[model samples]
Target: MFSFAISKSERNALFHRRETMATRMFLNGGVYSMADSGRLDARVEGLTIDPVDGRVLAVGPQCGPVAASDVLQLPAGAVIVPGLHDRHTHWLFALFANAVVLGGVKTLAEAAARIEAQLAEQATGWVVATGWNTGLLPAGLLTQSWLDSIVKGRKAIIFDQSFHGALISSTLAKEIVSKFPREAIGSYHDGVIHEQYVMLAMAWMELDDWTLKAALLQRQIIMGRVGFTRITDMGVMGFPLLHALQDIYRRGLMILPCDFAVQPWMLREDPLLSATSASVLHFQLRWLKEFADGAFGNRLACMCGHHRYSDGQGGKLLLDERRYVDDVLLARERGIDQFAIHCIGCAACEAASTAFGTVMQRLNGESSGCTFSFEHFETVHPKLIEHVARLQRAHVRIEVCSQPGFLSDLTDYTDRLAAHVMARINPYGDFRKEGLAWRAGTDGAITGDDPWGGMALAVNRGGEQTITVPEIMGTFIDAPLAVNGPATFLILDRDPFAHLEQLGQVQVLETWIEGRMVFHRRN
Candidate 1:
């Protein structure tokens, strides 16, 4: 196989540089050094990088260089910025992209036909499909009978676009119902599965270690090309995934640095405290993830009021409030300093805030440098925002990890929401004004993990709440580019601020991680 390798001169120059040496120069580019003052200092035209370890050596208009091969000169019109960070995503889902995708199918008939075709091609134990949008399908359209007609006694599981719900063939449904109880399965007749049952059914369709490792490696490469040097895998399962990641890193196949937030249930089951001590470079077990409610699109988000088109009743909560508080306290006691709670609605947000407030009060406002995050704070009601502000006033150190891509992905559904509810969606400017620390994420593979695409959605979704380019960039790149920081950044084909509306279309010309070029656009 043909391989792309750096020239001999380049390799020699890079290897010969001392740890304290400034031997590499990146010149003639609009360099965005994300300084601590929240200012966009883009006037710099050059940067000195320590070739030995890939850290920024100095930032200015000019830098000392030893050899031409050691210097990377930017092309005309190209701009360099800090590498993007996705605050929340399911790494497993991204790895499972090989599963039959049904993202754009408009109706139930289209979904069924696609599933039928997929199953016909595979002689399988169980067929798994994903990305069905129940919002587009008519009520009562996806039932056990409907799935049975397609699967024809074969076992199959089809997940909704939100991944919160699922439709299974009668064969699989009967098997699940028999193992558990009919009522425990949520709704056998409608073929709808939710909560823990979704995890249970998915566990049955297991992939071997090699398959998972390949999938993860492929996904990481794709993310690198899109300009992500680091990501936070929101809720990873157990040791298998971690073991796979360790194996990949050992084989020198790792691309991006990942921090895993183990699910609360998994932490409770094993508490894998030793896993944190395990020297898995590029991997950190950062947070304990808990779900407060379902997603907004499925009308299952724990809301203060009924969904506009639905049964005129608010959604249900996935985790009890008291239990959530207990979980937070327990996680802290176990030395897990951070928590990422999924809250997409007013009620869920309020519940999370209350739980966080209780934990803070008990700890006497000391978190030991730990942070609490409300993931997917999608529906930003003014009252909920106020509630959060009050918590911040008490030194709660709460952060909101939101998905700006929701504007682009769920446009139609959000448009049809109650006028009052729709008005509060993604209150980015409001969060900023209220002095709330916030960041943006893609929540892939539900949405495209394109950081620039997400930035465009945040920009074009016109409201006083819309975020500025600098502000959006701040969400991805938290700290300044300095000598000690990771040598991770991207070179874009065009300045993102210069082409705000076309941000999504702007190509990533080059991606660098730890001072090594991981991806370069082919001429």
Candidate 2:
């Protein structure tokens, strides 16, 4: 094989000068800098062709002709690849959002107990706690009495994990009555307030957007250290996006890569898109996030059949077909054509597919290459699978973001679900076998954001499938062009054997954006 080499001039020029060393220490009376203290770009001697971008870049070759600029040279044994992109994440909740989350508390008694303790702290005028799943909770109801007892005298409102519902105390209810018309608070009982009433109350309540962003940023930095380069902030909370952009500008820092899609209804009502600039846009797309149905775990997931527990019916559709169709059409007209729908059940998936097809037909194929993606394709039937495959054939990328962590929480529920239907849901292993691309999502509020776990869940077949390191990297590979994808070839540039020795689940050595280094192991 021909040896890859770099010119000597680049090496000397890239070496650090004395002053800017990250670490400099004297050993045996000689001072050696811990890092390339001066140069912005280190000179790498062993040039390897980058498979994805097709550039000759430096990588370390252990126990061989070593090059100083190669980033891998600093880490005793490691491999380098293009950055990892999450494609799906909800950073609005932050890390603490999932911790001590009172969302799943069963029974009004349990919820009341937790809230009563929280009320004692008297943190804020209106205490807000999230992470409640209605499907698993006892009685599966949010009543006024429950809210009042838990909140005591303080105004309180806790959002369901889905973000589609809210449980508010009587204090907040009184405030709601004062602000809106009597009709606005319709169907109001001491126990439950349904429909748009919750949202109306939240909108009226003053929320500190900046503080939420600050809280989210503090958590994002920790994610970066764990090797995450890009994350999708897939919710209506504009705080993370706003704060991330501001941070990048102020300090010339790049920690967490982000992509955000706003709610379509909000676009029509608030028009926040007009104020956003193109360069600052994450993922270079403005996807409209619409909900077709609720989540299965929460019993909010819409279904054609009856819900497992409820005799009346399954969950309701969060967005009516008319609303879904109108939003897609308006999103295209507004130049935000990318649509990301949250659909966990088959019924919901069909609605999303229908809406997307309708929008595409209406646009006469003038969508500027906009793609529609299904967020959590958790429960898909064979007919639906064929439908999605057909869409992909038509150049629409049908994507799936599954919460691997949910397997533990949902296994028993899934097994107890209709036997015929169980095969249709969370069948990622089958999807992979069919040559379909499966994108892993943290689904943050419900699952832990561990990419490795998601990767393992994607490839292995037995019990959700166990994934090898090579398989994990393949998820982001540009299929059709390369067998194992671009990153595979990139890995080949280094000492392949040694690199393999140091690989771990979800552990990344370096991160690059647009072919530039943004995060590297701090030797």
**Candidate with the greatest lDDT versus the true structure:** 1
Query: Per-residue lDDT of 35-95 in model 2, one digit per residue for the tens?
Result: 2323212322222324235333323322233234332332433334444556667655552
Taking all chains together, each candidate's TM-score versus the true structure is: 0.86, 0.70
After superposing candidate 1 on the true structure, give the runs of residues whose Cα lies further than 4 Å from its correct spot: 1-22, 36-38, 107-109, 177-189, 238-242, 271-279, 294-317, 363-369, 414-416
Ten consecutive residues with minimal summed lDDT in candidate 2? 25-34
Best by TM-score: 1
Tell me the tens digit of each residue's lDDT in model 1 across 305-343. Answer: 112233232333345656666777767666677877777
lDDT of 1 at 55: 78
Clashes of 1: 0
Each candidate: RMSD: 5.1, 10.7
